[model samples]
Target: MDRLIYLDNAATTRTAPEVVEAMLPYFSESYGNPSSVYSFAAKNKDAVTGTRETIAKILGADTSEIYFTAGGTESDNWALKAAAEAYASKGKHIITTKIEHHAILHTGAYLEKRGYEVTYLDVDENGVVSPAAVEAAIRPDTILISVMFANNEIGTIEPIREIGQIARAHGVLFHTDAVQAFGQIPIRVDDCCIDMLSASGHKLNGPKGIGFLYIRKGVKIRSFIHGGAQERKRRAGTENVPGIIGLGAAAQRAARSMEERTAKERELRDHLIGRVLAEIPYSRLNGHPTDRLPNNANFSFRFIEGESLLIMLDMKGICASSGSACTSGSLDPSHVLLAIGLPHEIAHGSLRLTLGEETTREDIDYVVDALKEIVARLRDMSPLYEDFVKKNRQ
Candidate 1:
């Protein structure tokens, strides 16, 4: 690993040095419980408040609306489950996209077993869900609509504002899992008409194990975690003072440099996509061509498996993924690719390369060169590729 290149920012990012520096003091010197009444711990409470304010301002939300959680998983779970419980009297019907992360999908399943009806809407070939379809699926009993702001696997940005408008017009609460979209793009809760949103800290160069759920005022959601009065009595347990500080520091840094950072990432991403598509035969890009995260470029090289591609890339000091980091280990192809109408063989060969602020044109070029060789080697060993070549020659 003499020349290491990390292109898996969507999976997680290296915490910024500034974020670490801000959190260090909270971990040691001023780490008293925020819940404590003593003046010594007052700073901890103030720190949490300040972090909440910083995060809320970024999303155009009120400070009281942001509730800290363990991470995106917890925030997503809390949003769906607690909303289901609180709104049960209104209706037990919920609507969501099929391409959502497992946090939403698995929680939807949990709700289904508890006697709720969930409609998993399909997306287009570009992985964009139609707002018309969402409106069409709306029922008198529909209580909530959960959609991801941007897809975690393919990096496709959904038509969230349109969907949010539909939800609002239907008098249904809308919750977006903004885990991948928060730091990468601009979002305004009020402008989008989003009633609730979930975001994680680690995705944006913040420390892991910290996230927040934004519940619009008067959304009427109940508590998910049962215990003390933390998170304004919505989520329970002790506050993570260090995590809060880190999340704030990361958020501020991301805001100040988002435009410049994403511009560079987008350029690098397109360069990677362009070179790979031109240099490699039978390689297809996944997700929307333009309406995607600036840092994301996913592709499927026919006649090669994703795991083998990842292994070869690792050998070349490159890091990437086949799909969502949470589900990359599964044998089945990505549901996102399948949803976008990719066949099993092609979907099985998908590769996801998510760029970061540190990624450069040199890095992208190196990855493309490695991929060209890797795909050629892998296909050379494939009997299916041989059969196709023979048939074409005939």
Candidate 2:
């Protein structure tokens, strides 16, 4: 069997050994409900508190402001819904971009159904939102502005710092879905003037089913989950002690080696992009060339279906994605691609290969060679390619 070259780090990551080691203690010998008042339980509760503090320190937020949740989707949903409800009296208007994750897009749709108005700003050809566009969309009734720190599909990093400043100057709250950007990039919520931020554990080589939302002090957000008094009555349910501990461990590890890891990933990612474009015909790279995530490399191969390409890559032991893992089953082209002005046919052929800390130059070489061969074979069988070639010959 060929060695598996896993390149789909944006979807999720393999849990680090350190994270697993940190979590094991809570799952067995220290298996106690974090909300319990008993001594054994109190120890677990302390661990949860410590984890919150660790996460807060990483994000430059206050310990009391961090609220743990199931994952990024939940955190995003909570931020949009809770803020809309809490500020309904002040205004029912929200602002975001067209390239956001479905977590933010779908949540915005839900708010619209409940009488809230949402303005979705457009992105440029490189899948980048303009800060001026955000400011122009702001209405007097706008209560909150939500934008993703980085796009999961195209890997385009938005102008979040400028957007954050716009929101602050307008006196509207700002929230960012930082699930994809949190571990890959350095984020200081205070420096960016971000009022709220959301992140997930699995995206950062930590255990799944654990994430956190950072709410700046005095931000009016209503209860997300209704039940016990966990998360200081903001979020409900007993805490996942093991998951939290693992997330903290993962966060610490990521912060310590972020600079070195990012530099290496960027080098490999750029090399892959350059090779694929130079080797393949009619291939176009997606997203901003220099401003995108260090680990993400997305491209569209003309005349082939993305699903077919993904299947071929999988058979070659090169795991890649057509787009977001959440939207893989859909027959329609990626919304992110369409928003960036790609035609339907071009959008349908997009492929994403996200790198990780463990990805090596050898793996990149193997995948690049595999992709070139696959694209050539796929194009040979494609009637669209034949027609395109014939038309160009004229």
Candidate 3:
């Protein structure tokens, strides 16, 4: 079988071998309910605690403040819903950017349906929301402010620390969907002045089905899941032992290798972006050049559909994504791309190539060469390209 080049780390990542190894014992010999009191469970419980502590330490958060959830979506839901309910008496308004992940956007919409007022702030062409915009959006009735640390599609990193400061001055709770930024960037809850944050394991080379929400010590939040005494009574369900173990291992590795990994990915990402834009006709970059994720490279090619490009790339043994994997099946252009001021045509032509630790320079070069061929071929079949050329020549 031929090796396929993977460049969709933003959608999800391949689980690290070390992460899998750490999870193996929990799924096999060490299998036990962390909530159980028997000796078999006691060992599992210790493992869970250790993992929790390790994650907390890495985030500069308290162990009790970290509530494990199923993944990023659940964590986003919990944070938004809990904030609305916890502060309903004080206010019923929430503010968030238009470019946030669907997790936050959909949850905010749900809150709006439930009688809460939501303010969707607009983003710049680079897909960045200004901190001042968030500050100005606050009202006397504002209860919380939610924004993503980094965009999943365009890879624009928001000014989260500044936004957090604005939220703090307004005495409003702040939550950031850090699923795309947590392991890829340095994040200190206190330094950022964030009240709550959400993360997923799979985005950071850990196993899927496991994630966490960081709730500040004094913040009051309602539980989304109701069940036994688990997750400090904040979240309820049988603990995902193996997934959590994998997440812990992934987090540890990320912490230790972050600087080196980031440098390498950035180098490759920038090289790919440069080469693709230089080699492909009518191609433009989609996000902030310097303030974006080290692993992300988004581009728009004129006169070709993103899905068509993805299919052609796959045929060349290169794996990439047109946009968010969740919305890939839908015909609608990505909300993130639209929010960045792209026209429908350009938005539909966008492609996201996110690198990971396993990605190599050779793989990037292969993708660049393949994309050059595919885009040229696709453009030849496009009536829009022919029309434009005809008009320009005349």
List pairs with backbone clashes in candidate 3. Answer: none
User: Which sequence of candidate numbers ranks them by TM-score, best first?
Assistant: 1, 2, 3
Return the TM-score for each candidate structure. 0.99, 0.99, 0.98
Cα deviation of 68 in candidate 3 (Å)? Answer: 0.6
Q: Which stretches of candidate 3 lie over 4 Å from their true place?
A: none
Write model 1 residue lDDT over 1-394, tens digit each, in one string.
8799999999999999999999999988998999999998998999999999999999999999999999999999999999999999989999999999999999999999999999999999999999999999999999999999999989999999999999998899999999999999999999999999999999999999999999999999988888889988988899999999999999999999999999998888888889988999999999999999999999998998999999999999999999999986799999999999999999999999999999888888888988999999999999999999999999
Per-residue lDDT of 93-157 in model 2, one digit per residue for the tens?
99998889999999999999999999998999999889998999988899999999999988999
Report every candidate's CA lDDT.
Answer: 0.94, 0.94, 0.91
lDDT of 3 at 238: 93
Q: Which ten residues in a row have the lowest lDDT in candidate 3?
A: 1-10
Weakest ten-residue segment in model 1 by summed lDDT: 358-367
Model 1 residue 242 lDDT? 98
Task: Summarize candidate 3's per-residue lDDT along 1-394 as a digit string, tens digits.
Answer: 2778889999899999989989998887999898988999999889888888998999899888888899999999999998799899999999998988898888888988999999999999999898888898999999999999999998999999999998898899999999999999999999999999999999999999999999999999998889777888878889999998898999999999999999999999989998998888899999898999999999999899999999888888888898888776999998988888889998899899999999999999989988988998998999999999999999
Q: Return whichever of 1 and 3 wins on lDDT.
A: 1
Give the clashing residue pairs of candidate 2, or none: none
